[model samples]
Target: MLGIKTVFTEMLGIDYPIIGAPMFLVSYEELAVAVSRAGGLGTIPLPNYRTLADLKKALESIRKATDKPIGVNIHLSGKFPWKEQLALCLDYGVRFFLTALGDPRLIANEVHACGGKVFAGVVSLEQGLRARNCGVDGLVAVGAGGGGHCGSIPALILVPYLKEKVGLPVIAAGGISTGAQMAAAIAVGACAVIVGTRLIATSEARAAQAYKDAVIAAGPEDIVVTDRITGNPASWLAKSIEKVEKQPQLGSKRWLDIWSAGQSVAQVGEIKPAGEIIKDMAREYSEVCRCLKNTLVP
Candidate 1:
């Protein structure tokens, strides 16, 4: 197996500098476990569980499936009982957390107290600096073309910009789906890459079969960034956008059928097991490195 090392892998005790980027309805125990078992970090979004018991059960299930490092994703701005969710996850021995949408100061302190790490999602240099000031261990740079709420900067620029400005280990997210893309991100100083839209096409993801098919069918042109669904600018399949535009009555339930995906959807051709996805990515990354060396040296 080809193993790639970075600050992320060392900090999270994983084999590859990759994370199964946490998705709202898509990421769960099965997906997380599969990614973790395949040598990358896996994370379950806290909002996926309605109650603490459900979250606990999911955590327990993941623990039984693999001893590899797993993380919990918390939407810090959500209305859910995040404080209690954080406490429960900590009690269950979770050492890694991914936070987004709000101040991470409190969460960072709590997690750090237990010798855990908290990586917050940031779309700009300002957000990155705020997260750093809030005591986060690292940043997940959500750049343009990312599936969910993302920023205007492209990963190629955002990764290096954040790396230069923030001085925290940055996990590049957005516009990345293949091993070559992963290598590009690392080459630009990203400590890791987060696989979201590509992972949704994986068999282990909890997304509906229709949603997976939609993702495979989508091209970069088929993706559109809009704030209609979540009140935050997020990329979605154009077909989904059309559906929502026509029905208008789905309201809160719109997200259930209105799928979110990044521009990387163009690269996803088929559904495979999550572990296979990770392994393939790692192999591709290695091959890309080899090719780069061969082509550039001569």
Candidate 2:
């Protein structure tokens, strides 16, 4: 079994150091439940909910499926009515939150007041420090090669930097899709690895079949970072680029018509259930650790 202890695991009360990163539209009740049931943190992306009732229903569904702790991801932009959504989540008994896109200070304070843990998604050292100062419990250090909006730095450098500089548990996000990569993240100081693209290909994910197919067929070179989709730097398939190339205005384009995936898409060769994926990762993690341990001279 893959087991490790860190502030992240302790705070979330999860066994495995893996997080099914909240992806808009893709992350919903089923996927979250599967991840939580598999002993990893499962997160519902708030944007997937059209209203407070929708969010509550999803939360209820997740509760029905698993007894494990559940988390919600809220994009911290002015247009999202994030305060209202946060209050709704609190009412629904959500104790873990991951915020991105804007200042997390206000949200962190509110969540902290309610005894909830808040983790800020950051791409750069400056953002990590800012999140720490905002009283966030930890940081999701999303680096280049991550699926959505990500920083230019690689996790190889960013994870340790944030762990050393921020003095908090840092969850590495980017280009991680296998047990070896998970081990690599921990070796570099991350408390866990936030998986995005890998989960997209999972059975529980709500993404379209075509999107999942595209990801399954992709390679590292096929993942392109483009700002045209959400007006922020995010990784997407080359086909997504081609789809949006002729659109005169970004507003005229349909967001999900194309697909987003990280450089790790190459590692996702098959579509499996969310729980099975976690177990596979755990098995691979154990094997990798065992192999590495044999290399040491007594």
Candidate 3:
């Protein structure tokens, strides 16, 4: 179990606490199933399918691909039809639900009733606390370098703040790509690290090779934040974003125009299978712990 601290593993019904962050379009049932089967929690983005029938088919595909428990990522901005989407998730026997972009309290009860644990996404101390009050099992604090709709705070800062402000398990997000970074997050009170970009570059992802190519070509500086497209400051490839943000920026509602990626793009350099990435992260994490422990008998 890579990065599997007991806190998150038990809550999500997985061997590892490492969660594949919900990426729009890029994260599909195949990707999710791969991660879960590889020992980490895999997440299926709910809106990708668009309709109940499509969602049902996606869920069935996930089941056929892997027996590992999986989660469904829900957007609460009142954009996607969550009612229709959620019913499908329940029918699929999902054990976890991760709510993003809005209040998750209202969604928690439903998930819980279906025997699922809820991991509500939050960008601030206040939002995390609110979700905690709503009985969410955990909080995924998406930070400064996290893909779309990122937070103003840095993950290094957000993890600790969330641990203090809320009683639930805290999963840190942002530019976390290596075990050392994952170790740092855990040392700072994070139960697990939510990895996005690293997984994006993985072979199992549904993104175009060009997208992965862009991530490899980019450095941290290459990722620019522009509300010029999303209204909310989102970090993405500057070259691609420049063109998208310039179209009079008719709001981010036009998701097709802009793409999303986190700053970890600078740290990652190649594309491998999502399961391979998960396996490697887990292996590295264990090595990191072992290397650290070799130092002493205090």
**How many pairs of residues collide in each model?**
0, 0, 1
| Minimal lDDT window, size 10, model 3 | 248-257
Using lDDT as the measure, the top candidate is: 1
lDDT of 1 at 280: 90
Q: Write the per-residue lDDT of candidate 1 for residues 250-281, one digit (tens) a residue.
A: 88788698899999998999999999988899
Rank order (by TM-score, best first)? 1, 2, 3
Where is model 1 more than 4 Å wrong at Cα? 248-252
lDDT of 2 at 140: 88
lDDT of 1 at 287: 97
TM-score of 3: 0.91
Sorted by lDDT (best first), the order is: 1, 2, 3
Q: Relative to the true structure, how large is the alpha-carbon lDDT of every model?
A: 0.89, 0.86, 0.81
Query: lDDT for model 2, on a 0 to 1 scale?
Result: 0.86
lDDT by residue for model 3 (193-271), tens = 8888888888788888878888888888888887876587788788776775577556655456456788889788888
Error of 1 at 118 (Å): 1.0
Q: lDDT: which is higher, 2 or 3?
A: 2
